[model samples]
Target: MTQRVVVDPVTRIEGHLRIEAETSPGGEITGAWSSGTMVRGIELILQGRDPRDAWAFAQRICGVCTLVHGIASVRAVEDALDYQIPPNAQLIRNLMIGAQYVHDHVMHFYHLHALDWVDVVSALKADPKATSALAQSISSYAKSSPGYFSDVQKKLKTFVDQGQLGIFANGYWGSPLYKLPPEANLMAVAHYLEALTWQREVVQLHAIFGGKNPHPNFVVGGAPAPISLDADTLAATSVNVQGLEIVKNVIARMQAFVNEVYLPDTLAIASFYKDWFRRGEGVGNFMTFGDFPEDGTGDPSKWLIPAGVILNRDLTTIHPVDLNDPMQVQEFVAHSYYGYSTGKDTGLHPYDGQTNLDYTGPKPPFEQLDVAKDYSWLKSPRWKGNVVEVGPLARVLMLNAKGFEPAVELTQKALRQLDLPLEAVYSTMGRTAARTLESKIVADQMSTWYDALIANIRKGELAVFNDAKWDPSTWPSVARGVGFMEAPRGALAHWIVIRDGKIDNYQAVVPSTWNAGPRDEAGKPGPYEAALMDRHTLADPKQPLEIQRTIHSFDPCIACAVHVVDPQGEELTQIQVR
Candidate 1:
């Protein structure tokens, strides 16, 4: 008999996500479905709006991803108008994006995903002295003290004793699958609390450059901030020498944490979960838009992370991605709660993308979604009609395939530490490890970008904004282009269509939409669905820790997956966890 288990409201992620899996009698998962319960209609809101102002509205797609949409939206307008920003602008954007990677990756590991691996209940049994020893053995982080671990344990005990585990509640703490000993769990928990404080300091980098952190202001031509050297000017707001020193310090702090904390913690945790390196390898194909421009944003060759597709785990031949080509990138809504203007079976490129809502699943508070019918709000995004995993793992694999020395060195070092083969990089734990490795690479490059910016400023180059195509009045009647970058989670692209100086149409296929989308018209599973099917087994169906371990590996951000609310405003579905 096949049994069904559902994890509704998959907590700790950005937005609402519900995962359903059908298991064999013995608890081996036979099939799975991934669904985003809400709709994000920010694209439709951009219709008829000025192309110059689109970045402000589009950046609101997700509070967590913050400036990525803003960056992409501005870049799309720049690409469409053939506008070139100054060199300083390019370097500033690089530093901002690089800081986001380091900050987002570390936050995701410690706050969002660490609970899946570290058993909090087990931490109570750990000796603080042992945990301090373990932390010191792994890394030379200055925070490794017996008293610090003891304080963390006391705080955790208070939560449990008060019947308020808070964020740590509802976790399967004593599961057999938790391979880490009590001391290791204690060390991870300590770092988890420390990351909360670390993230606040690093995000100041965004405020220093863009004027704010979340939903930072970005102009279509260049960065919004100006360069200044006036020591005492109250009216003029700009990035002066003092501000530059602050940014440098922030970068140094970010690099220190990635090296001394995030990387070591990931390796230490991974050493105990070696089997995960064999499981959760979904859709062997991978894709990346390639971010961090070394020179100008227009040149693909100058991207620090190269954009390409790797099919069937092939590292030798890299397929080029032309976002404008309809045949190369397309989204199908066959298994989604949407209807295309043309037809349900037809796949549409983002340039002609439509978001016609058609809810066909069971009403809210229901048990399981009808897998045979339209199930998810996310449209299945396919690259050449194939599912490709994206994010740090994809970027790392692409870099390794292209023989990039930094990526290769970091990846090989990690593999050697775990005593695993190269093929192991395709699994669940591999995804987590890849994120840590990527942070190191990006953190190292941040220094180069900072140095370049200072050198340009010292040479008396104060040009930050370009007014070449700032005004839409001097533009083409019709223009369309794709703005893409490798986001923290995966490949993210925004396609824009402008007509008569207004946004005629806009479509943003975010990173989570690519990884957590439903099956395509041909019934091919998306990355999340494919990874869970026939690979995971539940020791306790009521407590689905196995499902979380695999899903968190992808770091699903459902808030970015489905966009907007219906005008009718009626609650369409209510989630029922069973």
Candidate 2:
């Protein structure tokens, strides 16, 4: 008999996911499906709206990566209009995007993903003295925030004492995957607390460049920050060296945790849960749209992180990407609930695309080719009929394939420094570590750009946005453009069709759409679905947190791709804690 185990309303990550793992009588998972059950009709809401205003609306898709989406949407519109902003605009965009990365990554690590690995129950067993010592190793700021750890401990105690885990109540603390002693857990718990403090610092980076966090005001041609060349303006524009230093320092603290704590902790857990590396290791295919402008060229190949597509299973090398080439990219809304004209459910350009929302359960084998029976909010995205993984794993995989010396060297060094074999760097742990390390790489490279801008300014190279003449009438009668931005999660692609100075159609095949997609035309499972199949389910379903951590490590932004719903959908009273 097939039995179903479900975890509805998976929290922490954005969106509500109802995951059902179907297992045989022997307890082996035979099939698993993740459904995003909430629909906000963001696309439908954008209809009849000015193309320029789409970015502002798109930014509301997810609170975490709001600015990234906003910028990407604006970039798509700009590309559609063939409009280019000035150098100062480019620099400001870079600054905003970079700040988002730092803020998003830091928050994701501690607030969203940490609870999966951290055993809050173990923190109760920790000796406060030892925990304090671990904090000192992080940095002076960590040491100074003594009460933060205490508060976290108090909070955990209250929850555990109250017999309600609240957010963590259902977690599997005794699972074999949790190998850290109480002391280590205490240290992580302390860092988790301190991380909340740093979140404020990182968010200031966002407000400095973009105006706000959830949705920043970013103009298409340039930033929305009012330009000023006066002394006071220069002082405000002055790169907050200390603020950046605090971020670098905080990340360094995180790195210490990785090297001294997380890496070792992961291996220890994996040693007991060795079965995971094989399971949930979906299509070794990885793709990255490299980011960070080099010499102010929008050419992706010139970006600090070079963009490339790779078939990880075969390790095929990808050539340079061309947004103008239609044959190179296509979206199949076969499984999605969209209303549109349909042929083979596959086509090129804004005209041939269909948006029909007729999900008739899972694909019946005969109807699979017809694209009518598939059920999913996610569109089938294939890089030449091959499922490709996108995120840090993909980033590192492509970097390794290209033989990028610095990236390769850094990977090896980071792996070695963690006392793990080079091969370990290829696993889930490495993915987590790669994201942290990428920040270091980005920070160093961004500094070069910063210095260049400064030198140029001293040499009378002006870096200020001037007025731009934008005549919407000059736009094509019918124009289509693709905007490609490398989000913290992975390559983010947006296709926009504009006609008569208004948005005709727009579609975003976000990172999660690739990672968390459903079945496609040929009956091939999506990258994440396939990855989860091979996973050896631990003894208790409560420990599903392990599975959650592994998946969330990629920082899947499902909220931006599909819809979701609270399975319980029950309203509870909110009581303020004074």
Best by lDDT: 1
What is the Å distance of residue 393 in model 1 from its true position? 0.4
lDDT of 1 by residue, 323-405 (tens): 99999899999999999888999999999999787888888999888899998999999999999899999999999998999
Q: Candidate 2 residues 450-548, lDDT tens each?
A: 556555555765544433525677778887777778788888876788888888887776888777776665767776666656554535654466457
Strongest candidate by TM-score: 1
The deviation in Å at residue 256 for candidate 2 is 10
lDDT of 1 at 346: 91
